[model samples]
Target chain A: MSRFTKIALIGLILFPFAFLLMLSLGKQWPYPAIFPEQWSLSNWQLVLGGSEGLGNSVLVSVLLSLSVATLSTSLSFWVSRHIAYHPKREAWLSLAYFPYVFAPVILAACLQFFFIVAGLYGTFGGVLVAQLFITFPYGVIFFSSFWNERLRSMEELVKTLGGSTAQAYAKVLVPVAKGALMTCFFQLFLISWFEYGLTNLIGVGKVPTLTLRVFQYVSEANIFLAALASCLLILPPVALLWLNRAVVFREG
Target chain B: MLTIKNINKQYKGEAVLQGLSFTLRAHEMLSILGRSGSGKTTLLKVLAGLETADSGQLLLDGQDLSPVPANQRGVVYLYQEALLFPHLNVFENIAFGLRLRRRPETEIKEKVNGLLQRLELPGQARKMPEQLSGGQRQRVAFGRALIIEPRVLLLDEPFGALDAETRRSMQQLLKRVAKDFGLTAIFVTHDLKEAMLMGDRLGMMQNGQLKIYGNRAEFIADESTGALDEARFWTDLQGLKLTK
Candidate 1:
């Protein structure tokens, strides 16, 4: 690619984020004005000060994504291994796709009744569970290809080498799967991080995750606040992408 | 001695091993020759406690091993692939079983280094599995298994993937190590020559049954074992060359 082409592509990719950052700092732009009449740190200040609750939203989103990612990645890894080796492997694996068959919003709506009865509706825990309905199965499907005959043999080898089942996982399988697990965690984290529909329905406006806040500000037509929320929303996933790239490059 | 008695195994209602019985004396390597699906691997897995026999008893030194779990059975099963822990280096791989036993770091280092030297993998301790050649990887695997000092070593076509030259060298190395370590092992292979070359006693598996030969001559004379056929082929080749 030419230098001009490269620069153009880079700008193309970065323009929206730069625009968001600029808009987050700008205010009082009249109609037909390309630039705002005034620019200040007030919007950022409001978010950081917790007055706008954007900071709280950020915290909630981070915590929820982290929990969902960690839980689902680990649970799915264990579950997928069993399913891979099970006699009815195809049957069990097909069920992991069931959640994805319907949209997350529809799935959440379906599960809302159960959540209400279980006293989880309109709560952080409820949203987390709802998000898991999507991310967990994704994790299972993601890790399904990882468990093969060689890995099964490796596990058996560990056993025959005087290592217990736990030791087999800890000493060999888990370490061997470190890359896959990290990749799965990153993907699942993103799934939970940007998740909107399920969080909206299940949270019932109680769990104000950053995604919800972004949409809230957008609907309210508060462009500056929305931009700020959007910036906050992409931070974790961007950081995660950077980290994942570094890991993958180093491994390569 | 390791004694296998009336071991029967079935997969999907089809018998894989039918009343398979064998007696292996201490320090003896019994090589079983069979084609694929001949129940050779099933026999080894059953002995290693990786697979349970439908109705059989595995007696290691006259003690019942049927109830023991695989880890506690003191039998190491090696596959055709080296199956070395890719995350670990040569030294760590060799020391894996010892580390599992929670041996002292000094002891582990000492034994692993010594085994590395014995495996002719000296100065290659820091190399990862991916860095090693196929034969080298197998040697590391053998070192790993031997470091644990298992009661029986069950090898299922351990050198099946190696080139002819490497396979021969590996066979020699295994024979030397087996004698020096006084290792009692069951080496399963499909290669006719490998079965004869590696075994102190030979057995042939056909239709889920194992027939132990009384001696090499008897094994060669047994038509069903294909020993005679292999010998005749080579003889015919030699004759053709002489005639030309």
Candidate 2:
């Protein structure tokens, strides 16, 4: 909305175009122009390579995001509902987000150490658990206000209606809170999908997310496929961003 | 058939309810009137099992109620907002409780459609909550609560957020619904006029206590004491203005 923010938005939008331009036209350093003269589809095929690890990266990213979102969002429901509705919820709120409050890399390290001991090192399950640490904060933040403002007060109304806590949740709370829940799930998914700190460290150099794969290609100077992979990685969030932006979260 | 005996609650180091006691007989509509922070909402919460008392006994139909969890208690609460499910259309929202009991799809459809006809909200079964207007959404929330067929009904300023015209209309509709359902209704609000219009009996609360209570006519005379003090203050203000 501000001039600086507007310019920054323009710059980000154009960065991909510029990258595309370079992939097709850059024969030397710093081609000074607003556009590129060359365009080709060969860059697409070379990086695609039967899309082997590229496909794997996409699958792994999906798996990571889905698992982390479900786990974190589920945990957050309990934590938030109890805190908002329970008699002594205030006493628990102080320590509600300790894992969230800590730095991501440090948390990842501790998780990595724990995973190694637990025989989850270098596995998808290990990365999933680590990513849970990464995204659970976002889910908890997303679901807390939703549970409080809408469902917390309505718990009584639904209950006296022959509805149990489970029924109220399944019937009324879940229905009323669907948008928030979906957004929380998608938010955690996005966070986990893009999470590099935990994935890069705990993945033990074998597990390949699109993010890690992109880094691999970039480090190999394979910018063309990296760009394509980046494009693939950016698509999910870009589509869901508009849909889920209204769900309240730490981003509040 | 709900009874409260000497229940007390404290919030953040201040007492909100001190030795509160009452009963809700079957098929009666009770309205609670109060000033803000007078514990009207607290009373409703305690009765509906949303809150716990520091010390008291609660009974329903001569059976103690403390052991029952909120959901299993057969009490339905309606909030001021429509509080309908965003994901579900009107029909699904109404059929939710039935679905929870795992009712057969045909029976679920029959019940929901039957209620839709009875409520005169024909062919609105598929609409989303957001798609409906304020009154319509409120009706759908009522439909959702009503379809559960609970023993007790609690409405916490259920129409408080509506415009004045809509609020009056909702009150009439609610009264009709309570009669049709044979509900033991407990409506909570701070608006004395609304309470008078809706309640068979009225209870007035102040400073976390149920200070005065009686039927509609008696409640006005009881509150007239406080109202007279208010009138005197207004008369004094007028005198000051005239002198100025």
Candidate 3:
């Protein structure tokens, strides 16, 4: 591609974010106006100052997604090794696809009764669990292919060389799987970060994640606040993508 | 000495190793020749404690090895592929077992460097597995296994993936190392010539049953072992060349 085309493509890709930033900083834009009538840092200040609870929502979203991604990525990586090597590997792997078979809202609806019975409904814990229903399975499926015959042989080789199971994982498998683990964590984070349907159903408006906040502002026709929330929602994933790119390039 | 007694293994009700028995002397390398699915790998895995025999006894130095876990078995199994840890350089790979044992840093460095020299991999210690050639990777793998001072090395076609020249050189290297270290090993291969060249004693596997020959002459005299056929083919080729 030519330099001009490259620049144009980059600008096109960045246009929406720039537009969102502009909208977030502006207000009172009526029809036939290319720009808003007023522009200030007041919306950012209100949100960051914690008056709108948008700051709290941002915190909740970060912690929730980080917990879900870390928990699910690690658990699935460990679990998938056993499942992949199990006699019933196909059956177990097929079950991982079961969650994706139902929409998240429908799935949340199905689990609502249990969450209520367990006294977790309309709570942060409920939303976290509800997100796990999606992200954990995704993580399992993502890592299933990483455990192959060569890796199995390597593990056994470690054992026969007088290294224990834990040593095999720590010294060899985990180091080799660093890239896969990071990629899985980033993907699971994104899934939980943008998760709206399940959180809405399970949270019952109590657990205000940033994704839910974005929807709330949009539905309330508070476009400026909505744009601000959208900007916050995209921040972590963009940062994660940048970090992931660095790792990939270094590995390459 | 390692003794395998009345070993029987079954897969889906079919016998893979049926009442297979053998004795390997200390410092002896026993090369077993067999085709694919002939149960050579099954035997080695059982000895390495990676796989359990359905019914048998694995006695190493007169102790039962069945109850021992693979890590405690003091047996290292090498595969056709070098199967090096991709993240480690040659030095670290060779030092892995010592590190696992929490040996002194100075000791690990001394032993690994010594083994690197012995394996003809000196000055290549800092290279990653992918940076090495096929034979070099196998040498590093040997260095790794030997660094652990394993009681028995179970090699499952360790040189099989290399070209003819590399394979020949690796065979010589392994033979020299085995003698110098006084290593006891079971080398499994499908190549007839390799089987003859590498073994202090030889065995042939047919339908999961292992037949050990008393000596090289006995192995060559056994027509069922296919040694005679191999000789006949080469002799006929030489005769054709002469006539031409």
Candidate 4:
């Protein structure tokens, strides 16, 4: 890349984080001043030191994101095989995009009746199922490209080598596909981490994720706390994005 | 001994293999020559159970193998492209079959190392497939398939991707490997010289029909096999007027 392009990209990334840091530190600096009148780490202390139950919110967010990512990635890895190999795979893949086209909040509202009937309303399971409808489509699209003639030849190689079905998957398919699986896991994790609308409607305000807590503070007009929570939510995804770039681009 | 009786295959309502029948003697390597789209690959796929024939009987040692699945067919088909497992190193790719069979580690190591030496790739045990040349990668694939002790090895233009020098050396290596292992093999190629060099018997296919020759004299003399046409072309060139 050109030097100017690199500088512009770095500036674009750093400018937002710099503003968030300023907002999280300054107590009040209304108007005309280009800089904060005064700054302190008091808000950071409150957010990080468990005074606002931010620690619990972070824990809940991490656990839910981990579960959702793990379940969706694993489920789709196997399920995509059937869809990819089907004769009508193109038609089926187009249908798979239906749930994701609608807004997540609208979809959650539409599915709330089923959740209530299944006795999952106001529970973590309800929220997880709702999130699944969003993340599983990503997995399907990501994995659909995996089934080509090369993979078929590899599978036939296994069978002719006296391998069974279980051995073909365990020995060949999983090992070859490991890199893609990791990429999918990290992406799904980030998706669930930043989600708010579905969780709020389904968790019924009981299961407070970090995103929900950030919005709550924002509504109460607590700029410092909201900025701090937003920073927490944004940092991991940024780190993961950088890691993914390194992994994919370096290999190619 | 292996026998294929009246194998028929169709694709998109077109006949790719029609009433194809041939018997391969024990330890015999049959080289098949055909024009492109002459169904050489389809025959191999059916023999390897990668594709099912519409109707056929495949017999090994007088027992029908028509009902067998691809994995249980004991037939290995090597492609024109050496499709080695990219995630595996040279030794691991060769040892894949043994590992799946749960062979003892010592046995697996001894067998793989021995084959590596025979294929002249001993120093490449730890190297990935991407790190090897085209010829070396094809050798590794050969070792990988040979280690399984398959009933029939079907080679589909195995040296088609190599440079001329590499192709010659690989052909020599394969000739030695087949002889040393007493392997029953079917070699397919569009190159007449390559087919003649590799096969104990020769066959030609055109428009999904095959004709095999048990004798080399008849195979070379047959006009439809193209060998006589090649000879006639050379003889006719000798009669051209000298302009210089």
Please provide TM-scores, in order, for all candidate models, with all chains considered together. 0.98, 0.74, 0.98, 0.90
Stretches of model 2 off by over 4 angstroms after superposition: A1-59, A77-112, A142-147, A172-187, A220-252, B104-127, B131-136, B211-244
The superposed Cα distance between candidate 1 and the true structure at residue A9, in angstroms, equals 0.9
Residues B1-244, model 1: lDDT tens digits: 9988989999999999999888999999999999999998888888888888999888999899999999998999999999999999999999999999999999999999899889999899999999999999999999999999999999999999999999999999999999999999999999999999999999999989999998999999999889899989999999999999
Q: Which CAPRI quality tier does the interface of model 4 achieve?
A: medium
True contacts kept of 3: 0.98
In model 2, what lDDT does residue B237 have?
100
Checking candidate 2 for backbone clashes, the offending pairs are A157-B76, A157-B77, A160-B74, A160-B75, A160-B76, A161-B75, A161-B76, A163-B71, A164-B71, A175-B85
Q: Supply every candidate's count of residue pairs whose N, Cα or C atoms clash at under 3 angstroms.
A: 0, 10, 0, 0
Q: Residue A2 of model 3: what lDDT?
A: 100
Write candidate 3's Cα lDDT for B138-214 as tens digits. Answer: 99999999998999999999989999999999999999999999999999999999999999999999899999999
| TM-score, predicted candidate 1 vs. hidden true structure | 0.98
- Winner of 3 and 4 under DockQ: 3
* Tens digit of per-residue lDDT, candidate 1, span A129-207: 8888998899999999999999999999999999999999999999999889889999999999999999999999999
Model 3, A1-252: lDDT tens per residue? 999999999999999999999999997899999999999999999987899999899899999999999999999999999999999999999999999899999999999999999998999988999899999999999999999999999999999999889999999999999999999999999999999999999999999999999999999999999999999999989999999889965896
DockQ, model 4, C-alpha based: 0.73
**Superposed Cα deviation of residue B91, candidate 1 (Å):** 0.9
Full-model lDDT for every candidate? 0.93, 0.76, 0.94, 0.90
Candidate 1 colliding pairs: none
- After superposition, the stretches of candidate 3 with alpha carbons farther than 4 Å from their true spots are none
Candidate 4 residue lDDT tens string, A171-228: 9998888888879989899889989889999999888899998999899998778888
Model 3 alpha-carbon miss at residue B28, Å: 0.4
Off by over 4 Å in 4: A1-12, A25-51, A242-252, B241-244
